[model samples]
Target: MNDPKLTPQALWHCALGLLSRRDHSRLELSQKLRQRQFDVELIEQALDKLEQQQWLSDHRFAVVQVRQHIFKKHGPLRIRMELKRKGVNEAYIEQALAEEDPDWFELALVCYQSRFRNRDIPDIKEKAKRMRYLQSRGFNSDQIRYALEAEQD
Candidate 1:
């Protein structure tokens, strides 16, 4: 419904309501507005206004998300994938990943200790389990092995 009567003000209000709760990519906002049947032009106008005011920023979103993900022990690969899914630009994702410096080995060891504190297993089984766990959390094999080796030391 590209109703000219559907004012930009209404769309802006709706968009602000959504943004107030959490960060969203422009693509995500566009899709939501489309489902609401707002006029495409009106929605785009509102989005442009928001961007002009710095209320809608893909770079800021990427930075915040990457920081939080790393803090929660997520690896760069997983964080990058998530940012891409959220429609962040490739250059922004690359910059954000480069800016983040996490101690994967330490974090992985901590995670391993937390998950298998009292458990005992053979070296092979333990390594396998650790590999699976870290990999599932989006860590590369190298990081996982380093962490596991650190645990063994």
Candidate 2:
């Protein structure tokens, strides 16, 4: 690692290279640069440059993150909190989440069925277990309940 005191440009280049490989939230990119001992001011400048060039965008980050995380079987609540932790703005998160259709509950149920196929547990116990699993994945209580009941029907 170049000395933080002497190589701001090198640090920026390195960070940009890393970022070019994937989308990174501001906080995430900051933490990565910090681990290399880059000065905070220098890191911020690099990040600002990237943003000005449109190479870094929180809006794009939020959209891609939500899409990718949901595809991995994560629930919306979990995805939302994770995006917040990654430093995505609240307004963007809310807007993206709002645009998502409410019919996702049925999709979630389908996912659960696919994953747990071929095993038949008793209804009450099964619903409880399913609820816990979905809740841990970040679904709200209502969504989880609805999915569980729909499974029974």
Candidate 3:
């Protein structure tokens, strides 16, 4: 190899250092190792070892991500898209969502309220604009409807 950092020990050292900072998905670790010019085979071995040792888990990553998004009041739809982009498994995503989010309607209302606090429902144009904004935030039509209805109270 052109660089001593390309060695298997060096690769493991680098991977462990990355993991010590925080959890990462397999794909994320692979991408980071590739960026550092580590051998693909070595990267695979490192990932496999990490998984066997329970250091890297898509499940754990998905759970933390879901909790963070829920705390931020982001809708499930947006969270799903983001986790999918990170290559998380669909099953894990669903599991995480089920464990973390109890009601999308409540989350949608919080998100809407945070953005449009104390503002009346206004005219048709403003209502439509609000609808579109919630949609962009990953709320389904039903959740948006419930949120808007609750706001009218």
For every model shown, what is its TM-score relative to the native structure? 0.85, 0.88, 0.93
- Candidate 3 is scored at a TM of 0.93
Q: Between candidates 1 and 3, name the one with more favorable TM-score.
A: 3
Question: Which residue ranges in model 2 land beyond 4 Å of their true spot?
Answer: 1-6, 99-102
lDDT of 1 by residue, 1-153 (tens): 356545676788889988998888887888888887888888888889888999998888888898988778887778888988888999988887777766776776676677777545577876687789888777888888777777666
* Candidate 3 CA-lDDT value: 0.90
Over the stretch 1-153, how does candidate 2's per-residue lDDT look in tens digits?
Answer: 355543877777878887889999888999999887887898899999999998888888888888787777778888889999999999989777776544668657766776677445577776678778888887787777777667667
Q: Pick the candidate with the highest lDDT.
A: 3
lDDT of 1: 0.80
Q: Which regions of candidate 1 deviate over 4 angstroms?
A: 1-6, 123-126
What lDDT does candidate 2 reach at residue 80?
A: 85
Please give, for residues 10-113, the per-residue lDDT of candidate 3 as tens digits. 99989999989988878888999999999898899889998999999999999998888888878889999999988899999999998875688988998898
Please report, as a residue range, the 10-residue window in candidate 3 with the lowest summed lDDT: 113-122
Residue 115 error, candidate 1, Å: 2.3
State the C-alpha lDDT per candidate.
Answer: 0.80, 0.79, 0.90
Cα deviation of 136, candidate 1, in Å = 1.3
